[model samples]
Target: MERSLSFRSVSILSPESANGRNVVALGVADAFARHGSTTIFRPSAASKDPFTRILLDAAESAIPLDDSIGVSPEVFRSHEMSMRADIVARYHHIIDARTLDSTVIVGTDKSPITDPEEFSLNAKIAADLQSPVFLAVCTLHRNPDELLATVHACEEAVDEAGSKVLGLFVTGCSPERREDTLNGLHELPYQVWTVPPQTVDPQSEDSIRQSLESFRQQVPADELIQASEEDWNIPVTPLQFQYSLLHQAKAHHKTIVLPEGEEDRIIQAADFLLARDIVDLIIVGERESILERGDALGLTQLHKASFQSPHDEELLAQMTTELCRLRSKKGMPEEQARKTLQDASYFGTMLVVLGKADGLVSGSINSTANTVRPALQAIKTKPGSSLVSGAFLMCFDTHVALFADCAINPNPNAQCLAEIAIQSAQTAQSFGIEPRIGMLSYSTLGSGKGPDVELVEEATKLLREQAPELQVVGPIQFDAAWSPQVAASKAQGDPVAGRVNVFVFPDLSAGNIAYKAVQRSSGALAVGPVLQGLNKPVNDLSRGAMVQDIINTVALTAAQAD
Candidate 1:
């Protein structure tokens, strides 16, 4: 079951006197988005700068060009606070209706109001929104005393207006001087984070995302903040993707049966998942071996584990009988079934078939054939799915794309390729990606002729006739599939020609090699080989998988069970 989202809001104010206020605002919005908050950024009344537009775009928020108004800066700052608040309120109303959780960040004018009377109006605006005010204070190469005075002014200004100060954003700190400036505010009671000065391309998505993660970590957990901290140990996958998997897995609370339970990485991942209450784990292996391995690794979280030995007599007998019944048409006998069930892959798959576990995740020490063959034999495909397929969730720092047929299907025909595309789109949707699919080939539309291009073109036609509601385009090359400008030149007015989040390959060799190349060359993280089309979820992990890899696969398996 999906959890209901609750709404929360916050606003940002800067010492109109501060330099780099725009940079600070961008950093804060990024922080909110990174933490899984649907963020809405409303520029200050005086903010019509290009950087502000770029910043909003980076945050995936847009303030319409029609909202841009030409007003005298002095008059706008004087009485426009109420009107600006109303505009923000309207945006909040619309966003809150559409989303369960969100953050609204209202930017402040360039200069802090110098007069005490004007400062009171600023506070009233904060009060009107009923949100805690986050003050962005850029040192501007000021002395310690000047910075301290600015902080004092913010504290007093929010306090006087019946509004609360959420925290202080310290920006424009030279990398070497960051600690020195932060230390100067040791006496301040509110939260403080020193944002690194922006690079020449400060508005770059990757840079802003990293800074937001860093900034959000400085905030106290109790504060009205939403953001995730980056884990250096799991640098390949994005933290946001990890968080999404965990959130869904937690909601489902399904059981995952791990076949390579005694493997060190598998044991560690199982320990973490069980301890975190993300999944109910059942490890299939020799109980004593796993326990000893867990102990030697100092796995404190292993005490929470549940173990199942493949050699257990009752389980073996029951699974053997079921296997014989399922494969008997192929002339399998009871003895052969019993012997085959001795392998943990078959045994774990049996657990899902027998309704003892919701899903299975293997391939840690096994080959893809070893992990998948048993699943195909036992759990089989869903009612309408002809054959199983796999997808890799390719995650970059700020974006995620799905590459499909990467781990299965050596060479699918037009019909099989069409199925692969449709299945991959469903899989992408399951992971929260809106699937705009690209059926990739060497050609764009009818530009090239070859068996490969024909295969992709036929698959695209089949997909359109079968599921026209699906956003898809085919016989599209990689460049045109991804770049809108290139798409315009090659395949105009086709929705999926560009802006595609899902890529469907004609064959396994192409899918597998491309995802790996992108993973290796672009420093993008590839999570899975997530097996799809199974009646019950059973995923494979690379043999060189890390502890985090197992954890991710397990969570995804649990989520798929739902």
Candidate 2:
């Protein structure tokens, strides 16, 4: 059986006072509204408080706050059960007035820190409303075990109160203890998220929007949503695009191994990654040296990342044995495998191969070959792919495009070219870009002829024979592929002539020069050389990659992980 939505409504409640619950409510409501119509209702208060006005200003409310039948916070405190019944009645009244794809029910606010009696009140109200419940807890100043205990208590208490606990949101856990909190939560059987402390005050409309944006940037994209096909064409700044990449990584938490952890930029990137809880991380380096460098830079979150020396006695021995066993057909000896395990790139790649990590990001200080070789030896190309290729995601203000073979495969044959195009389209799809490929050449539909143009034309034929469902326009010049007027004059009446997002160059020289020129001259944010067709994601960074570049690459690597 197939279900479209796992739940039609969610009740965001708290067993106690959680500071960011309002912001969480807005973000979750906005997420559901993006795909379909969603209503926001708060029934515990008839007075239009700041949060209620914030919801109204955000255009998420089902009705006016004062119009809904709600109990006073004082009255609720005095008569908990009776007010809980009134709150449920108010929710039904508001929801019955409107038709919505989803509804977000904001439960009563806990005004006091020691409001012990209200622990199951929110849960019981949600149960009466027939909605699943999300528990938001203020985890400030709490250790990991203590935080986990609170979550378990909430789960059991909610269950006893006759409501299903949907998810857990922890706010304000210290960076020192966040890693442990997340690790412990991962052992549980449900979804748990560590949210950044809300920054903007929720009193005003502008601040409310800011708060929603903050939550959108930090947490997973619709963590409770199981499916959506909505497209938000909203334009974003470069910084926002980077945040989108981070958001994609956080949507599914993956563990990425960094082989160039000794580099300062890599260490700095790790700090950012771990601080944001974007992914679980493992850094292959001398733990002491890395932590010392991080401390010197005033980095607070590096301690949260798991660190491993390439030559750790137990790990090195285990990896060496595994490597020799994997390569015994090539007559690999124990001594040779052990020596290979000492190299950071090889060790990190082996971690991925042995299922200790999901993906590997390296080449910050090493050459591209040093990073790609080990992955090729152990991970190999993805099934059904003939060869590996790379694509640089060039992001503009409004949209992002793919510039391919930019940093891999110097001179691809026709077959290599076809595979590159196919793999790149798949890569674009995976990264949430709709692939409209333009096989770029010096010619526009044979307006100018050369061996290069002929090669692209042949590759286009092969691509059509293989993945005919792909949108492709080949043997086309850049002008025709990009500009509508130029396309009209050159390849008239062709659907894909001017609306292409994936650019496939004839060779590495064209791709490398083009992406760099666009990056430096046009000031586009170039985000890859994201290697595609790997069995597991292994991304290579430029030796001169900046801190921000490494951060984006690591996020992309995590997004690509299995």
Candidate 3:
């Protein structure tokens, strides 16, 4: 059953009560009979007041029992008032024994009581009943002592019974007295609810009924419930991404090389990836020194990985032999070649050539020219490819497109463009993209004229002749390459005009700017500068790249190596 609970107020200032008829107590007893568990109003009894002959008439009206329950006037004494009220009233009896099981209890002290002991006793009884105590106290602008005594009584009641004091309600205060009353109660733990003076006739029946109804609804139910903290998900921050990638070694698990290993950021990143179980890491440095540095940095828990210095004897010997074989006709001596191969880049390239690592990523601490020069010499280009080029995987959500030769072949000729187109197509296909080669230039079909247009057109022809199964179309503008309507109007018969996924740039200048423009303007994620046409996957890192960038490059290189 959905039980409803409400507050019942007792009028302490009734005309009959002021006239010494004890009508207020009678009214409280009447309320107890009706509500079953009503709060008694306690205001100060000013003197040894005498009961008038009219009290007998008021008492008769107060008794709500089905049959009369007789009680003597002596039982109405200060101590006896607590006991006799309980015995004569059904509501008081249920409340004192705590069997009522109602939700709220609002008690008001309407008149000023001089005896602190009596006030404390009454409050203790209410608190012991285990009902939420709502105390209403009257405040006069100048009587700070009365206010303090009442506040102390309320606090003592709560402490004595181990019950919560929800708040205090201040009544009979003037508008100017409101702020002082609030300030006086501020030191108490309970919230304060101020009752503004009701200037309209307080004895009016309609006003009394309306005030009582409003008071009943204002009683609080159960305490407010809060949301569980466990339901929230931790957001991923940039630092977390960097740390996870480094400690987990996700990049290395796929078999890629990282060039800058000993640096602070790199080591921290490695430690993070390792801690997160993201990837297996391989560092290219002296093993003993790397471990010591890791220990010093309090990354002692990180897993130690294999390291190979470029100056190692076996690597130098192998580099010497390979360089001698490749450049012997140019009169390069075995000792000179050995000394040159002592560089880390040459050593990393040898690791790739010897099938030790799937790919290599360098250039963080070295120039791109220095990093790629060793690979170009040692690994060489793929069969039938005269020049190497670069490509990027541009992704936004699930949509992926390839931008080629953006970082390599500054001014690719017809032949170089053809190779980049074909290679980019293959790379795109490898990454699960259906390659539709768009040989991008400044012109669409023959609508515009330029050397760039001629270069792209000639490359498209060469690509068709050499790789006939591949779809190739160009000398097309960027808009026509990506838009179906434009392609349909301008290059109607071309196979890869509008739906092109692989964009082959005419040269590095256009490719770099175009890819950056597309990335910045469209908010696309640029994934590569993947050095294609190498015998193995050996990519380069930007100098300002983060650890996650290193990890991603490694993963991409490993994917290509596979």
Candidate 4:
């Protein structure tokens, strides 16, 4: 929530025991919308927030509604401080994404809030947003004097937290007590809005608009502050990462060729991508057969997908020529090239190389070798890359880490290891992960000496030589690399020790095992084996991959495409 004084904004929350705060919050949000471009930001367990949904429906620029709503309340319970920072960052992201002219900062209305310090949480979030606060108190179905005490107590809470209270509204009061309540609040120093119960029919737009107009006129314009920039860096949540990945793929509008259209998973993924309009999809299979299969599966969305037959005479001829020319140095004769193009993987890769499509997704029914070999032969590796590598986006609830060399390498030598590290870092960067690498070992800072450990140390040195700006820690145990307490005891005073987001394992056995262990044990969403270091984007899905897996790989592949 950076400086945007041009946009009117305020933070509204119930003080401890207030009722009907959501009503006031909604009114305020509606009022702000009258002025110009307006957004609503609610920070809490936002997975299923009704109020946020309403606001989202009204906002012009739509993202996932939960995108503006922060983490689950239970998540915020343990990760209060870090999650608060994340909430602040989400606010900033929404503002940037919406390019807001106005915003309404709101809180959840439901009870059973898990965070014991609920008021404090909202207070700090408001402080971070650098917006003034409005504490609304409800005097419905209760004694006015007792509610006044709650209001008085809340004054100190917001004030002690240094939140400037712009208004203290006595909202939701019934008509019978309205006059007495207003007279009773005459002694109060802060601005007050004694809003009686709204009487208009729920479906009347004119009444709603009039109420909103009244609320807008009431907000003190002179006190409104534009959001200003702050130096806030927080990890994006898993939900956020997935949404962002799909959103980017949709925005770039890249066409991805899916080679295993015969596989049920791939066909379903084609439907999934097409249903969302995420990308223009091409499913490589015999057109008639794929249509028959799609019909059998009740996947009408697949109607939008273009089906390409690898056996198409003209396409095969072009691919044969291109492949022979690209692989001529390796002695790929015309006969071999023609035979290769018959394979769907090779045909799909050729489509990308020929610019018929932007990227390729294969391997649902093929081996990784079958999938990657065609790309390696025709598309080749980018500059500074001598070998290809694979990275998984280990998406934890509140952050994403890139697990490297997990699929491609078996037991790379020091130089190959370093190259994997470099490629992994660059891949992570492209995917929005700032690479803080942890080169894993059984030893930490020479606690044990072995050839394996020596190889890791040499790889670290080589990685630093190749990419000096990366934050890397090597010859470190996994625990030390992840846990600050463990790092202090094992490898003290190293900046990158405890905060590693990119884990480069010593070998495939370790890398594969580690990612799987964390994924299954902790319930993290592991997306990829994102094939890295290729000149063009081509990803291989596991044979056991689900339909969703195909969709994810296609989306990632599209994002990687130019």
- The prediction achieving the highest lDDT against the true structure is 2
Model 2: how far residue 332 lies from native, Å: 2.9
Candidates by lDDT, descending order:
2, 4, 1, 3
TM-score, each model?
0.65, 0.62, 0.53, 0.71
* Pairs in clash, predicted candidate 4: 2-227, 2-228, 3-227, 3-228, 3-229, 4-226, 4-227, 5-226, 45-73
Q: Residue-pair clashes per candidate, as listed?
A: 4, 0, 18, 9
- Report the lDDT tens digits of candidate 4 across residue range 431-516: 87888999989999899998999999999999899889999999889999988999988988999999998999999999999999
User: Residue-wise lDDT of candidate 3 within 1-562, one digit each (tens)?
Assistant: 1223433222222111121112223322333434443323222221222221122122233222221222222332345434423322333332333333122222222244344354444443343232344455656343756776766765665555334444555655566776777777678765554544432223455644444343334322221101101122222222222222232334345555555666655666567546645545567777777778888888853454557776578767876787888777777898888777667777677777776777787877877787788888878898987878889877642246789999878988899889999889888877657788888888888888877778888898999898999877777888899989988988887777888889988888989998889888976667678888888888887777666566556656756765
* lDDT winner, 3 or 4: 4
Better of 3 and 4 by TM-score: 4
Off by over 4 Å in 1: 1-237
Top model by TM-score, which number?
A: 4
- Candidate 1 lDDT over 172-262, as tens digits, reads 7676777888889889876677766543244466765565555555544434363222111221125446656876898899999998886
Go through the candidates in order and give each one's C-alpha lDDT: 0.74, 0.78, 0.58, 0.76
Residues 1-562 of candidate 2: C-alpha lDDT, one tens digit per residue: 1123533777788655556677677777777777666667675654767766565545455566675436777776776545654565466556554666777777776564366757676666666565667777777766677777888888876676556676777876555666777897887666777676664466555776677777776666666575222222333334445655776788768999998787899999999889878999999888889999999998999988888887678988888888887888899999999888878899999999889899999999999889988888788898898788889999764467899998779999888999999999988898777899999998988888778888999999999999999999998999899888999999999999988989999999999999999899988889988998899999999888998899999999988876
Evaluate candidate 2 by giving its C-alpha RMSD to the native, one decimal: 19.1
Q: What's the distance in Å from true for residue 208, model 4?
A: 10
Give me candidate 4's TM-score against the actual structure.
Answer: 0.71
Output the better candidate (1/2) by TM-score. 1
- For candidate 4, the 10 contiguous residues with the lowest summed lDDT are 223-232
